[model samples]
Target: MNRKILVLFLLILLSQNIFSATRIKTVEFNFGGYYSATDIASGSAWTPPYIIVNLPETGIVIKNAYVEIEYLSSAGSAADVTNIDIYFNAGTSATDIVDNITGTQVPDSSGESNLFVARADVTSKITSWTNQPYSLKFVSVGSPHNMHSAKLYITYEYDDTSPIQIKTVHFPIFSDSLDGISGVISTLAQQISPVSVPFKYRCDLPESGITIRQVWFEIRGLRQSGGATTDGSINVNISGYSSEPTMTLDGALTDTYRFRYLSSTGTPAGFAPNTLQTVYVNLSGTANTNILGGEVVITYEYSNNSNVKLKTVSYFFAQSTGTAGSVTSFTVPVYLNEDGITIERIYAKISGSYDSTTVGSIEVNSAIAGNSLTSRIYQIVVTAAQISGFEFYHDLSEGRSYWYNGAPITISWTNTLAALGGCAVELFITYKYTSENKYTEFYRVFAGQTPNEVASAGVYNYTFNLFFPDPEYPVGRKVLRRTWLRGDFIEG
Candidate 1:
């Protein structure tokens, strides 16, 4: 029975050892030390001894080790202090040299403490120690371990006073894979919409005191996706208006506006297939001066991972301006016609006054010989009370002449003027004859005149007039023409 019991006990011990080997428990060696100059003899000639500490016993071993040292300013005043060497020893004395190691030293010009590092052979030592069991020691040359039980060392002249000390720190090993994985995943998601945000603007009364006639919106998207690493995993789309009309003192009308998108963020990108993409709208018209209100819309689409996507939209509107008086010079297009001739060109002379201090712009359109002659458009602010008008000229005449007997020449004109307060004006149409052969045949004919009335501030009526030239002039190889109203006044 005793022999059988001994054999059973041996079997149980062997099973326990096998079980311990199969279960892995990770362990690390961390050490830290510092030396204070106050602990050393002030006037004695002595070198601090280097010291090293061994790690705890564990089934898992030290995989890696990092050592850093900080020097205290009070340690020494000697500027000649230069070299510092460190070594790893297997035993407690200098003879047991496990590995010869050196630390990187830095200069301290300000007499302040600096840091040093001993990193060579660290990886190889870690690999060997982790595979088996080993001991480690930290040793210094001129600097000795001053503390009674500390691993740090300091060396300096006793008479060369200033407090001197050394500090050593050791880092503990932990699981980096678990901590780093979350950060990597977060970084990957941030790249998808790094700059995808909506933008907004408003129309307000600036210090300059000028009512904004129109507003324009421009938007651009920078692409941050595509490459071997990114793999074109992201896509973006944008759509928005250039300008949306707002209610002004008068009414709403299409005004000046533009929107554009490009491939590159620098200049306008050229339109190409499978390159950059863009969408834009230009909203421009006369603002409604009477009831101040208006709005514009913008939309976008974002795609990541080809299967995941997002959409966003936004809008902007106009604010109201509190003022009084009927808007005169309401924005409108003027029209005109000339009878009994082939109309070559038609000019409308305008005369008016506006209470608003700002100048206004004018637009014109016309037709001739069954062809739409709508190319001559002009814009100018009415400042001085001179004659402001629209002129229409044809590039190619449809074999039609303005001077034929009883030829009914038709002329059309349209005008748009902007201003504030009640406005009243008179427009005059003038006609002239021009030919390549004779510079002396140019003259004016019967002129047509009319008056315009403004019902509200910032609003005016666009007037159209027609005229027929007198039949008493010589009819052979000549043109017939008429002139409309021309004059001016001041707005109240």
Candidate 2:
């Protein structure tokens, strides 16, 4: 009788403690959309400039919520730039969540101009709000400073019971400086020729038939530089998109232009092709307006039901510039440290200052092995004629497959001297990996810049933010694991 009781007790204990993995999703709300920094001039409680934080109205359990603020200041010294007060108002009442929050200097800032990042955990307050549009207000203290941008991130625990899951794919639209001082979109392709941008999406798979969710196009920081009084406007027509989106800036106000477009329903018309895809994004705008900086963000969704999964990674290297009579070489590092990662392809976008009339060519070469000694694997050439504006972007296709071990691959390129300013290279690598999960999944996020290289001996002081994986939640983290610094060293 005692032996029978022991067996029953063990079965009951096992049944009571069933464990399941935690699932989480984080949504980002960008407040200022890459607009130029605004001066927070006075100390007196500045009237509230309410910013919207987009969150789902219902159906989810939020585990944690945090707000990250990025700002540029030339106010006083870093010491005088002490603290800022933050408040949130749902509708009727205003509650102070973080009072006198400290600011940490970003690694990129130097001298009197400083960049700062301030974070606050508002899990309790954010979870309590039962509606949409969480607006926030900021109050500065001590010396005045400039506010660049603010973002709200909310991570929620959700158990998706349905077979269909919504996926969001985001990629940069354009990262070039449009100088319109001479009254044209400059010499870039937006004015001279057509620019082709290639993006990837998972749809109509043989295993688990996927579906389209929605599409969004976001353009940020569209304005004329040098305080010029020339009104500027741009009309962007993306191939396969439903309609053309336009952004305009008034000559008198000096305010930056931001635009966002969302489809009414799931539109797979643009992404109907199942194989490799290409789309032409044309830009047309007014002349005599020097547009400084901007980016295009495309968002889409798909459905999955297979075990075969897709993973993508992007890395941004330091900017390199070439002189008029010198040969410039830039070595970029590509790291893929995942187990069983079969790399499909790599796409690179070299954006910076390029003159269409310049005479030069850039070549990319990789190292590979064949018989005995490893030889130069393959090469692709980019010439001045092919470059329309300040960007030369394409899918590096030389007909070869790449597999990742545990080491980093270095890609070096040499360019002849031409009328070029500076260039920054960003690479996107996609691969397929197997998982035990029943349905295929897709994960996407924008990549951040790599850390700057340190000098051997000098009084160099700068602060920047680096994202790393957390040992506790490795699955939840999406970031670059390894990076190498590549640039030229010149004595001043």
Candidate 3:
């Protein structure tokens, strides 16, 4: 009989050990209360109070766990409480436990703790409070044991200034795993005065190159007071040089270069202020060349400002082409307004052996209006019989003619002519005639190398008086005579 009892005891002990090995341990918190057996016996109303719970961590696993809360009496001994409400992680509704006595007790084997409560119905669980204390009972559904924390809150009407009236406890439970998030990366490029600087970049991988989707940039360090400090803008282009590689890339390499303008930063100068402009260039291309290095050159114009620069900086990009290819190059043109000279009219005359073909065409243009004038022709020649007349006076005191005849005529003469010599006499004669009734008379005699030669169809006047042998008698006489006045003729 003793041996059989010993064997049964040993078997029982072995089973207990096995069960203990499979059981999972967990940590939980609860807000405790009591239930009345008389309430069930007499069918009285039972209202369960709730408690708040909190957890420190999130996204973990939980195994088996129970919650415990202590009942406090005014006299400091174990107190019997009724209508106890239980909660899990500050759940909304309370689960009722019928018990006549209360101190500290574990939930039942049904995974129903004295603090077990219903699920919460709220959007955000963090930093939120419920009207009851709650507890949760769960079994491990997956591997990798992890734990999360939640808040447990108890609701009770208390006297003013009572610290123990409202109590909160934290509890931990198993939850899902955490997920990782992605980060955003970007860059900016700008141009300063007196220089053009461009920013360049390259991905670590070249063969299977990186894809650049977007680019944004702005100019900084501008003053607000003067309009001199202003903002400028620019657009990026993808077209490359003819000698360089073409911008056309296959598949994911298309649309590799994009342009954007940046807003102004500082106040404008005067009515038209200097601006600090920013430009952005977006690139999206798969590198397929061995030479992935390149550069960007920023270009712009400075208006109403002198000694200013179009490009302030140049940016270098170290590239990994990823594959085998040559380096690509690109260029941009910048325009500016400058001060220029204005011409009204230009006159030119042709003389002596001027070649008609070599004369070239004459063109006139207006700088302000940007209009051009028609081309005109120019030529020079001599023709027909010529006769010229002039008066000469003999200046006895100066020993020279007061006025010389046949002086070279100029367009600038105002009053016919000016007496550059002394007093002289005037003589008239017709050319190619010698008879008394029709004599070829010379109009006047001047100091010239070819004095006999005359200009035709033109009037010649001199400041001196005429000196005929008999001045009064010869006034109206029709006679041709070769006579010299008493004066020294000046040579032209």
Candidate with maximal lDDT: 2
Q: Model 1, range 1-492, lDDT digits (tens) per residue?
A: 000000000000000101011111112222222222242222222222332332222332332232222221112221212233333433333333332222112222222211122222232333332123233344433332222111211111111011211111111111111321111110011111222222111111111212111111222111111111111111112223222211111011111111111111111222221122232221122210110111111111111112211111100111112123322212222222212222321222222222222433322233333344333322222212111121111111222242243222333223233342222222211222221121111111111111122223433233322222122224312222212232221111
If ranked by lDDT, best first, what sequence of candidates would result? 2, 1, 3
Count: clashes, candidate 2: 7
* lDDT tens per residue, model 3, 1-492: 000000000000000111010111112222212221111211122223333332222222221122322211111111112222323344545333312122221111111001122122111222332223343322111111111112222111112221111111111000111210000101111112322223222111111111221111221111011112111222222223111111111111011111111211111111111221222222222211110111111111112112211111111111212122322111111111112211111111110111111112211111111222222111111111000111111001111111122121111101111211111112111011011111111212111111111233333233322222211222333232223322211111
Residue 470 in model 2: lDDT: 24
**TM-scores of all predicted structures:** 0.19, 0.46, 0.13
Q: Which is better, 1 or 3, measured by lDDT? A: 1
In model 3, state the lDDT of residue 159. 23
lDDT of each: 0.21, 0.36, 0.18
Residue 139 of candidate 1: its Cα lDDT?
A: 44
* Candidate 2 deviant stretches above 4 angstroms: 1-167, 170-214, 218-229, 237-244, 249-282, 287-305, 316-345, 349-394, 397-400, 406-423, 436-480, 483-492
lDDT of 2 by residue, 218-322 (tens): 332222222343334433333556443333332322222222222112232454423433233333332221122222222222333456544444555445656
